[model samples]
Target: MAKGVISAADQAEQLKQDGNTYFKKNRLGAAIDAYTEAITLCPNIPVYWTNRALCHLKRNDWTRVEEDCLKAVQLDNKSVKGHYMLGLALLQKEKYAEGIKELQRALDLGRGAHPNSYMVEEIWQELATAKYQEWERDSTKRSWELRRLKESCETALEEKYSRDDVSQKTDDTDEISNSTSEQLAALKLVFDKAAEADTPTDVPDYLCCKITLDIFRDPVITPSGLTYERAVILDHLEKVGKFDPITRETLFASQLIPNLAIKEAVEAFLEKHGWAYKMD
Candidate 1:
């Protein structure tokens, strides 16, 4: 409370503001410098570290981005930006699983804290893109595995039938026929197990959008706290006028917020129960 002396927090805030100005002008180096200075002054502030991480992200410096965001998250475990940046960094390094996990965490946190904020949508989109990429990779791997299995099965059957025993050839043919049936049954079991793992149970009604009656991909909340698919609601607003479909209360597109919590919950449910690429 000194008359002329400025507190460290105040000085750091000024530096952060300066950083924002530099960032807007595309002066990434200068923005990073300002943010670094702010961090030096107030090392405990997670935003300063996240701001610096943003500059590193622009420069494609994944290592530095990971380092800064890790520090940010260490300081504030609930930090959405920290988790988001860390996810991007890991993705750049080709750490798909870890990166996707961090993105999901960011989506969860951002949704819980600011359900209607742009950050929540951004996180959801990024998570969706990452999951798609993962699905592509898994699809390719599965195809290759299936081909290999088919080749192996053919080779085994061929070897069994090529036995050199003329004395018992007829008996051998009968036995081999039964063996082939058993092998086919085993192959069918393998595919059946895979299908069983991927098959989802009946979806809950609350999780489905009112318009589409399907599980939500991009759920948004009206002012009345009712959730619907973003695309369906926008279409409804344009065609049916501004009103809640169920309640018939006044509603506006501007008043809708991305229902991130529901999105997160749906994603978690799908991860455990649904087939790959089903959500997409």
Candidate 2:
């Protein structure tokens, strides 16, 4: 009986070798069949499962790859190839967190003999990129939601005041007014604190344009080169904190402000007001 067992093991080993040859020759289906036969012959061999997993991966049979890889790992806990293949299979299925953990484990195991070493590294990079972008998108969405909520609260408070004055109001109105006032005051305090927080040195040009546009209209010049509206000078003052004639010319030349269309519209409006304005 022992002799028969040894002979069976030898046959399984020979089958596995033939499967590997078929795999190397790019005969994936033949290789898979051979590997399956070997596994049936000697179900205890981790190598048979691992090789079969590779064949499944080549065939894009992700579910089979995972099954075989899990079996390989269960049979041999230290099988780095099994862990790595499992990671790949999970990543292909978009199970990012689990795949990341498994890939990290495979890397820790430090076994580079697996065929998917480069693929594993590439997947790690992709995972990191995707995670960062997702985080950024979520953060932006949260910020917008918070801003909307704040605006809604402020509008509701204003509408309540518009409906009735607190001094002559009923008890329910008084209580609501008090609560709204408290909430608004708290929100204002938080907004103030956020404004006082440390921020980036480089303020966006669009923000500057928006703030400046609120304070001043674009300048208008007569056809005889006499200026009517001092809008350009005011814009320069808002942007640079102090107006400098040289800087104004430089800003126009560089087109640093992105809303040139708005500026042109302002010029047209000025022209309609009997002043011919040259934006440049």
Candidate 3:
């Protein structure tokens, strides 16, 4: 047995470790190269595609992120990262309805089988954004449809009564014809609530980070008793120095603690909008 017989899997694992080292050092290009080599050597490994996708995500390359994530999920449907990154990429492409599905699937799979609570919180935030976008889209569509219907009804009524025989329209028909917009408005109100088939955009200000003006992916409470997004606060501390932006109280990165209540509230919101949890 000579010493020159390393299996392809072993070689791939070595490349994967190298990629992780590069990733930690923030050398995303090198990390992607290493992951690409590993994927070439072991195309069946879902992690390899996910690793490359994450590197792409770091660079904000949504198209490549989408491609690699799709590949990972194709290999292993249970890959949480695969679904999550795909969701992010899709969201970037403004495919909110589809992105919401992938994100919810990532959370569901991550909770029971993978169980990364931190990642789950981020997924919920992403899911909320996706659902909000989806709601906006549906809202716009419903408005357009309602207007179209109202115009159509008005046109039909005018044509029917404009005839020399205005008497053909009874009192009941005249009343109905004049109430087109009103009837449509009532119908729209009912369907608007129902159309929240996904998440509602009326999220409370308390649930959002003042800095980002968005819901927190990782809410952390500062010593000043104010909560902010974790990554956002960390960046602020690094670049702007440690201080509560709102309270102007001196702060330290180490003083931040996980705000579990907010995380749970976000999760509950997503649960209520379960219809947004599947790709259309």
- The top-ranked prediction according to TM-score is 1
Per-residue alpha-carbon lDDT of candidate 1 for residues 1-280, written as tens digits (9 for 90 to 100): 9799999999999999999999999999999999999999999999999999999999999999999999999999999999999999998887889999999999889878886577887787787677666766666676677768866886776576666334457767777777777887787677657645433366678889988887787799998889999878988999989999999999999998989899888878767653244443
Taking all chains together, each candidate's TM-score versus the true structure is 0.72, 0.48, 0.58
Separate clash counts for every candidate: 0, 0, 0
Question: Global lDDT of each model?
Answer: 0.84, 0.63, 0.80
Error of 3 at 226 (Å): 24
| Ranked candidates (lDDT, high to low) | 1, 3, 2
- Candidate 2 lDDT tens digits, 1-280: 6654567788899999999999999999999999999999899999899999999998899999999999998998777778878887887886766775776676556424442255444444444443333344444565676678778878987787757665546757766678778978998888656533222122223322332332123233322332322444445546764524443333232223324454466444432322211111
Clashes of 2: 0
| Residue 2 CA displacement from its true place in model 3, Å | 2.0
**Model 3 CA deviation exceeding 4 Å by range:** 114-116, 151-280
lDDT of 3 by residue, 1-280 (tens): 4599998999999999999999999999999999999998999999999999999999999999999999999999989999999999998988887888899899888877744367876787677667766766776677677667766865665565455236655656656555655765766676556555543345568877889877556688987778898878878888997788889888988898999999888667655654244322
Among all candidates shown, the one with the greatest lDDT: 1
Evaluated at residue 10, the lDDT of candidate 3 is 95
Provide the global lDDT of candidate 2 against the true structure. 0.63
Better of 2 and 3 by TM-score: 3
